[model samples]
Target: MSGLDDVIAAETSLSEVDGLNGRLVICGYRLEDLAGRTDWENVLNLLGGRMLPESAALRERLGMARQRAFAETRWLDDGIAALSITEGLRALMARLPDGEDQETALLLAAAPSVFVPALIRCKRGMAALPPDPALTHAADMLAMLHGRAPRAEAVAALDTYLVTVSDHGLNASTFAARVVASTRAGYTSAVLAAIGALKGPLHGGAPGPVLDMLDAVGSPEKAGRWIGEALTRGERLMGFGHRIYRVRDPRADALKAALARLGAAGDVDRERLALAEAVEREALAQLKVKKPDRPLQTNVEFFTALLLEALGFPREAFTGVFAAGRVSGWLAHAHEQIEGGRLIRPQSRYVGPKAA
Candidate 1:
């Protein structure tokens, strides 16, 4: 009660944070299991507590949602003269019609799969690839981002990434989403709130800088010295540590294993995989010596950079891809919050000027 007990509450289905043991679980399943064995759509269904409408029904609904989401991409063209990509995305998402219903909720969640990649591709003067009306959500996203349908391996890797991130209970952005949803706002409203929260550097602006760090270091040999300098400057390493995951981020290994499968099948760049392995070894070893008292481990963003980079996505596009997959979880959480019948409003203790 002294501090923000809402932040530390045992009930709220939030922050099952086991910092001492370094483990995170969502909805009673290990992050590793979803990331390793399932596709994004399946994981979404798991978190959402619904089957994906039997394959045929899912494909049909997904096709319709893709059309709805893709049409919004045109708004970005007008933004070429004015607004930034994130702003444009905010604008487009805001325009999604309001409702707490499941149909509109799916559309709200699927919008970024169509919009973000289209905007990024348009900025680079590349034509935006259309999503297949028949593919699963993750597959369609990868197809829409890249002209050729992603290889099976790429789809698998992306699916795992999505599963890893679908929802981590009341992560900052998801909590923002629930806050809006609790107001009986439409699903789009909830997701828009989540997107705004996610756009902040402290919350989700990570993968881009991870790529930048990798580019700056240039090779495995440089990782140790570079990390030492970064530590000396009291800088938080972009890909190291997390609010959860004390021993190692289970998601990191999940995603890494996903990438390894892609490498096994020859979809990922060999050199990139080699570089990541070297960085992993050097980073772990050096982190031990540099911060002897604290535990620092690789989180999802490190391998996420390598995987998304190999998948032909630009570093700037990384978070957008994250959004594409996570929106499902957002929608689910939104729906769950509404069904549970509680406003997400929490209070803070007065810590300033009480006497005054």
Candidate 2:
């Protein structure tokens, strides 16, 4: 039972990660159908069992929720500002009241967009900008972070990223959230638990390093050499490979396409995207030759690094931005676990010394 590989912890209709076939289905729609075609709000509604038409109302409610969460920024201080963005988020989220209602879910989902930007501003000695309730969620997040309205292409790219990551089958953070929710702790607590789990490097922390790897590689001409040398040193390439996906991760392609679109719209650095693509190719070629048995391919974190970097987020804030998209999934999973009404208590075999 190492790492619960192949274990069916619980049943969920939220999303399915088909690592074998290289497909993702979120609430009956293939990822490709919804990712760039629709907005994150619609995907959020779909995961929550609401009809797509209701996304408009959900958007409005989420907007109001962000406004409400903004008032709590009065508690942000020098101590909180000194912490990492994710930790700062946890500290602020602790102030939220525990509850298991739809309103609480919206609040939990909206909290990251509010708190992350505020924490970034506070860290830089700038005043936190209030969220505009009339703007869409993705737009408002960029707007709040940069203190201006985001351009249309940036909004679409951000929205696509959020939707693409809205949910996946029982990832580490989602499982942590569900475990806490099974205890009836409350949505806020469950979300807090999920955020703590995502803080780990193995889960949500590699995107920043992906950017670092790109910086070190510098140009497409050096990609193969750097990748080969890194392989020789027995180093794990940051964005390639996954625990479950034997094939290329579908989310990776979705994100790569988003980055391409951003480049086409002139909102991102086209040369940077070209460099990333070169790096990806070299990494894939080197991985195939070196690993041989393992199908190590690019994962979501690869393009996630590029896209977020192009969008003006620093490396340290990458995980927090990931949390912004993932919170919706965490809330949905929490509600589902709460509805199931069973504590996620598992038995562990005592392999320690048996003699007494």
Candidate 3:
């Protein structure tokens, strides 16, 4: 069965999702290799590929894109006191003009602009912090969010996150972007469509719920019971299971290992990591009882919540940050779509009344 109740797209090279075997490939690189080691700029380079010049030119291009996006935060000229980040983001989005070439890259780079400033504006009861063009990409975002630069490890962790999520093959959001791209819509339209798709409960929105589950379970000791109850009620465990990656989210191990590299494995980190593992095991056990035919396993969201919490992003910002990374994939797809010059047109068998 297909996901489209609203729209249809034939195919695209944006990314591939292999749900049964638990594999995801972005462009040509496996996700695990790219997550922690590659910086956002590097991932952007990889995604943009030969279209982006190598070395200094690439850095200069990313720098330009970042600055262009940074400038867009000024569009937050209205709405306050009660607007949600989603509302604010959609509003700011409207200010951007359509003629911008491959508009997806700018939107992708602007994820920090949409999220970081909105975070501060909501918290500070003011407009928001301006983007600091001088800082590195992740560092600038953290600085905007907190009104100061982030610590080294935290910055690195965020970089890991952006790189990790930069793209995934045929995820709901990326696929949506490709679908829109197939229609030959302007790039920004495709990106906006992707963001709306991702906002769905089934996609990137799962991280915050994972955090809540962790809190309710409260300890590693209660993990098994929590899993049992959630399964009993037919409530899906937030962190466990992937539409792709049957065994594990390869990104999970990659991110956990990155967290270890922060060298902050004090009691808090250790406990969080342990509880995460415990939850994974118990969830798997319960899933075996309930869903024997298809074994569900841990997705990246479980550890992503813990890790982002450790890095000081509030639970609310988790999905926003995910948007920040996924925009990169959207841009790549936009570029591919534009170059192909194929107007995305698909036919569906009509099941509704039409004039004969």
Candidate 4:
């Protein structure tokens, strides 16, 4: 069971990752059916078992939650500021008033939207702008980050990104959250644990590097040669493979479609999209010949990079943005684990020094 592959750790009515079939199901709705059909507020309401208010009301509530979480902005200690985005996010979450209530969960979900833009602004020596509680969550995030009203296309693209990443089946971060919550720890503690898990390169950290890979390859004509060389050197072609899905990731297609929408609306760099499509084609073709037995296809991380770049986020902030979307899923998983009423205590077989 190396890497805990194929392990069934818990049961819940949240989301299911059908790896072989390349399907993602949230609650009862297919991910594809929900992607362009709803926004994050409604998605949260769906996963939260309708405990969350309706979309319009929830938008107002989350907007207010963003403002409340903004209060922690003043507590951005030097240590927090100096850390990486995910680390800084966890440090900031640790500073929130400890609680396990729904209100506290909402605050945790709202905190990243408030803080990520501030962190970006702080790094550039720009003063952070206050949240506009009236704007939709995605629109408000873009406005805060850019210090101006964002294009409607950009807002739509970011909303799709958020909704696409909101929840997946028992991912590492969600599992970490559930494990911590099983111990009766507060919601903040569970979310902090999830953030730590997500910071690892094997998980949430891959998308940023996907951009780096695309950059290094430089052009469409060079993509095949570049990927071949990377494979020869045993370097991963970031964003080209998934741990679960044997086919192209559904989220990849979802984000790619969002990027296309932006491109059609004249809001994104279409040349870059063209290059990415070429690279993806080359990567898939080369991967098939290189590893005949393994099915490695473009994943969510592939288009995640392109979309976030289009939306004005630095590659470094990718995981933090991902956490912003995924926090709701963590909240749901933690609550489910707590309600399940069983502590997660898995036994490990010792393979170390023997007792002779």
Where is model 3 poorest over a 10-residue stretch in terms of lDDT? 99-108
- Indicate the residue-level lDDT of 258 in model 2: 88
Off by over 4 Å in 4: 50-56
> Pairs clashing in candidate 2?
none
Query: What's the TM-score of each model vs. the native?
Result: 0.90, 0.97, 0.87, 0.96
What is candidate 2's lDDT per residue for 302-326, written digit by digit as tens? 9898888888888899889889998
| Best lDDT among the predictions, by candidate number | 2
lDDT of 4 by residue, 1-356 (tens): 68898778998899999999999999898989888667777788888764455655777889999999888888776666788877777777888876777688788888999899888877777877899999988899999999999998888888899989999998889999999999998889999999999999999999998888888988899988998999899888888878889887999999989999988998778778878888899989999999989989889999999999988899889999999899889988988888889999999999899898
lDDT of 3 by residue, 1-356 (tens): 26553343535554565656666677677776677767887787777754455745665555566566656665555453245555555555545565325334554556544455565456556656666656677877777777777787777888888887888766688777776766776667777788787777788778989888887888899999888887888887887777657687777777777667664634136777778778878887889888988757777887788877777677876777887777777778766766777776666677798888
Tens-digit per-residue lDDT, 1-356, candidate 1: 64243454214442245656756676676676567687766665556554135543655776788788887666666455155556566777887898976678667766887887787778777776767778877778778777776787887787788777777766777878888988998788888898898888777768888878777778877777887787788877778887656688777888788888888998887866666677677777877887877778998888888888877778777777778777876887777788788776667668787674
The superposed Cα distance between candidate 2 and the true structure at residue 326, in angstroms, equals 1.0
Considering only N, C-alpha and C atoms within 3 Å, which residue pairs clash in candidate 1?
Answer: 22-246
The residue ranges of model 1 lying beyond 4 angstroms of the native Cα positions read: 1-19, 50-56, 80-84, 354-356
Q: Which runs of model 3 end up more than 4 angstroms from their true locations?
A: 4-14, 50-55, 77-81, 100-104, 111-114, 263-271, 352-356
**Residue 199 in model 1: lDDT:** 83
Runs in model 2 with CA error above 4 Å? 50-56
Residue 161 alpha-carbon offset, candidate 3, angstroms: 1.3
Global lDDT of each candidate: 0.74, 0.89, 0.70, 0.87
